[model samples]
Every structure is written in structure tokens, then in C-alpha cells.
Target: MQALQSLADNYNYFITIFLMVSGLYIVIARGNMIKKLIGLAMFQSSVYLLYLSPGKIVGGTAPVLDPAFTVYSNPLPHVLMLTAIVVGVATLALGLALTVRIYEAYGTVNEDQIFARDNKK
Candidate 1:
């Protein structure tokens, strides 16, 4: 009962782990280029969530050098996540562009089909 209660209290951690695993599974199990990209995006999102989860503090104010403010939420995690998001977006765009090029060259985005065709030639 205690374990169950603790699990329920820490639901966000479970959700983050689930998303990470599912994303990895999708990337590994799917052969289609678009699906793989979607999985990569999911994986990236999980990381974003993981980073943001701990940085948030209820009733915490910004880190201002003020005597009135005693509790300040750490801004570093949010800043890092913002940069990570930008990098993730750029990576996703590049991946999509490469997938488009691959589709244009092969007329198919399926990994197995591409490999089979390559083997024949």
C-alpha cells in the first residue's frame, strides 16, 4: 500500500519513463523514415519534460537580487531546456529533409525496401 501510494504521488516520474521507453521502442521497432522521425521527436519531448519537471517550484519567484525574495526557482534548467528545444527542432528539420531526399531518390521511405533495392544493385 505504501509503495502504491508513493507511486501515485510520483506519477510524473512514471510518465516520463514511460514516454522515454515508448519513444525508444518506436524508433527501434519502426522501419518507416517518418515514423522514426516521430519517435525521435517523442524522445526529445521526454527529455524536455524530464528537464522541466524538477526546475519548477511552487510559489517560487525568479532569481532576483531582492531582500524580499527568499525562494527562487533555479532558472538554469529552463534556460538549458530552451536551448535543447532549439537544437531538437533543427535536428528534426534536418532529419526530415534527409528523409525527403531519401524518398525522392528511392521513391520509398521503408527501410527494408530501401535495403533490398540497394542489395539488388
Candidate 2:
């Protein structure tokens, strides 16, 4: 149905929002470092979805240098998304590294435990 198609077309953004909220909830409520990483991945995946969905055109062609080709593909969004992916990966790596350090220092990754320990000092 046309209505279903329209829903599908907009579903990516909704899914992205869900992922982001789930990630935030995990980050706030979870006790494990690995779970937090998974949440972070989810958050980033949502962003990737956001970047990818808009760049797609139904009747667009790839931007090639062939003389026989027309319809220039909108490459800006793709390029921006590539950059975003790189930055996201870097941020994830950094976050993971920080988590590792937190684990080493606190012997537990739970936020409450960490806060309690800090308060004792």
C-alpha cells in the first residue's frame, strides 16, 4: 500500500530515536561497561541511519564521469556520513578506553559504586 510505503520511508528516523533513547537508558541505569558500549554502539548506529536515509533518492544515478550518464547523485550526504562514521568510531574507542581505565581504578563499572567510592574520599 502507498501508506505503508510512506511509513517505511519514515521509519528509519523513528528507529533511530528508539535506539538513542535505549542507549541513554542503558548508560544511565546499567552497571556493566560492556553493556554501556553496546548502548553507545546503538546510539551511533541510529546516527548512521539518520545520515543514510536522507541521501537515498528513488530515481537517482551514481555520479560517474561517463558522457552517457545524467542525474548527478547527491554525494554530499554520503561524504558527510563517512566523516561522521570515522569520528564516531574514534569517539567509541576513546570511550571504551576510558571505561577500561574506570574498571581498573574502581574494580567495578557501576556508576553508583563509583560515586560512593568518590564520596568516601
Candidate 3:
């Protein structure tokens, strides 16, 4: 039971690392920019997960500064996660826009194919 609890406590962090690695793998192995964006999103989400995991308490409220509220939750992580998510979304949008530009310029989305054609030329 103790081991199980310990595992549960650290599970989110482990998952976060796993997701980060998976995202890195996708970004490195995939040729399509859209796929890379998807991978980037996964990485961002994992970071959010990491932030949220630390702020978790058994009983917590939304960290609103109200006089009536006595036991306030840790809002720092949540706020940071929200900001991170926004930044991540912006990055993804930018990446997708860049992919569109790449497609327009090269007429192909595959990196290998583009390189091959370039080499031939």
C-alpha cells in the first residue's frame, strides 16, 4: 500500500517525462510540420501536467482571494499552466503557419522528398 501510494504520488511526473520524450521523438522522426506541431503540443501539455501535479492537494478550493474563503488553493501553478497553455497555442499556430509556408514554397510536406528533389536539382 505504501509503495502504491508512493507510485501514485510520483506518477504524474513520470507521465510528464514520458510525454516529453514521446513528443521529442515525434518531432525528431516525423517529416510533416503538422505532425511536429502535434508533438510540440504534447510536450506543452506534459509541462502543464507537471505544473498541475505539484499543486494538487487532497482538499483545495479555487484560489480566489475572498474573505469568506479560509483554505485557499495554490493558484500559482494553475496560473502558470494557463499562461503556458496560451503560449503553447500561440507556438502551435505559428508552427502551422510556417508549415503552410513551407508547403507553398516546396510543394511537398515530406522532408525526405523535399531533400531528394533539392539534391536532384
Assess each prediction's global lDDT (C-alpha) against the native. Answer: 0.91, 0.82, 0.87
Worst 10 residues of 1 by lDDT: 56-65
* Whole-structure CA lDDT of model 1: 0.91
Local accuracy of candidate 2 as per-residue lDDT tens digits, 23-118: 888877777777877788788778877877777776767766777766666788888889988988898898889989998999888777899999
User: Candidate 2 overall Cα lDDT vs. reference?
Assistant: 0.82
Candidate 2, superposed: residue stretches over 4 Å from native:
1-5
Residue 106 CA displacement from its true place in model 1, Å: 0.3
Best model number under TM-score = 1
- From the highest lDDT down, the ranking of the candidates is 1, 3, 2
* Better structure of 1 and 2 per lDDT: 1
Model 3, C-alpha of 86: deviation from truth (Å): 1.3
What shift in Å separates residue 58 of candidate 2 from its native position after superposition? 2.0
Judging by TM-score, tell me the better candidate of 1 and 2: 1
Q: After best superposition, candidate 1 residue 47: deviation in angstroms?
A: 1.1
For model 2 the local lDDT of residue 106 reads 90
**Once superposed on the true structure, which residue ranges of model 1 sit more than 4 Å away at CA?**
64-68
lDDT (0-100) at residue 103 of candidate 1? 94
